[model samples]
Target: MSPLDQLFSNYLPVFLGTGIGAILVISALVGSRLLAPYSEERNKGTTYECGMLPIRRASTNVGMRFYLYAILFIVFDVEAVFIFPWALSYLAVGPQAYWEMVVFVGILAVGLAYAWKKGALRWQ
Candidate 1:
């Protein structure tokens, strides 16, 4: 068989599944919009927050600390993702894999310690 045909045959189930999923999602969305009731009540269109009408524009300045905390969380979260696969196969891969993970985690630990010392974890 040709390589092109062989490749498609191998991935036929994946392609069919993806196409079916896309169709199902699109149909559900279109069906909901078509079948759902349309209403034009006066209060229904207004934004409600904490059962109180909004007095001003919703846009507000966020603190820089919030972004710093978020970035730190993302960095550590990605580190943990790499560690998971290494841990699952650590036994078969032996000491070299174990030491590699240790160095990876140790570097992160140092960074965490630095952040702690700098008061990044503190919320005020």
Candidate 2:
């Protein structure tokens, strides 16, 4: 077989995956358009969350600290999660990986320091 044919054969799974994804998406959209509910009125359109009516207007001011703590939690939480795999791979990959993790942690520490200096952690 030619090089192009060989390449495609080697990557057939990838192309099949993409084609399958496209087919599924198109089928879902078409199926929904044909069979889904078409109500566009007052009761069917109103927003609801946690089985409660959304009372707060989106433009109203809310606490910034709520979001700050959420963001901080996600950042460190993600960092903590990533460190485990890095720690596990340390022996197989040797000290270079450890140093790379040190650098990664250092950068994260710098960002955290900057945030701390700016009082993002404060409950005010």
Candidate 3:
């Protein structure tokens, strides 16, 4: 068989399975919409927050600082997560892996230092 045929033979089952799954999901969504009861109640369209009646408009101005803090937390948190798997296999990976991780950490440290210098870490 040719290379394309070999490739298809190897992954044909996976492609078929994925196609079947997509078809089933689409059918289920369409079936639910067609078979389920439709409601036209006005209250159903209203904004509900924590089971309490909304007092004012939902779109309110929020401080950019909150988003900055969240993004910084995510970046550092993801970096911390990479350390765990590296630590587990460090012995096998040896000195190369160690130096790579050190470089990665140093880059993150520079980013943190820059943020600190710019007062992004300040709560204000």
Q: TM-score for all predictions?
A: 0.62, 0.49, 0.53
CA shift of 103, model 2, Å: 0.3
Comparing candidate 1 with candidate 3, which one achieves the higher lDDT? 3
Q: Looking at model 3, which ten-residue stretch has the lowest summed lDDT?
A: 42-51
For model 1, residues 1-124, the per-residue Cα lDDT tens digits are 9999999899999989999999999999999999999888988877879889888777788898999889999999999899888879999989999998899999999999999999988887
Model 2 is weakest, by summed lDDT over 10 consecutive residues, at 39-48
Q: Which model scores highest in lDDT? A: 3
Alpha carbon lDDT of each predicted model: 0.91, 0.89, 0.93
Q: In candidate 3, list every pair of residues with a backbone clash.
A: none
Winning model by TM-score: 1
User: What are the per-model numbers of colliding residue pairs?
Assistant: 0, 0, 0
Candidate 1: misplaced stretches above 4 Å?
1-38, 50-52
Q: Is candidate 1 or candidate 2 better by lDDT?
A: 1
- What ranking emerges by lDDT with the best candidate at the front? 3, 1, 2
Tell me the lDDT of model 2 at 54. 82
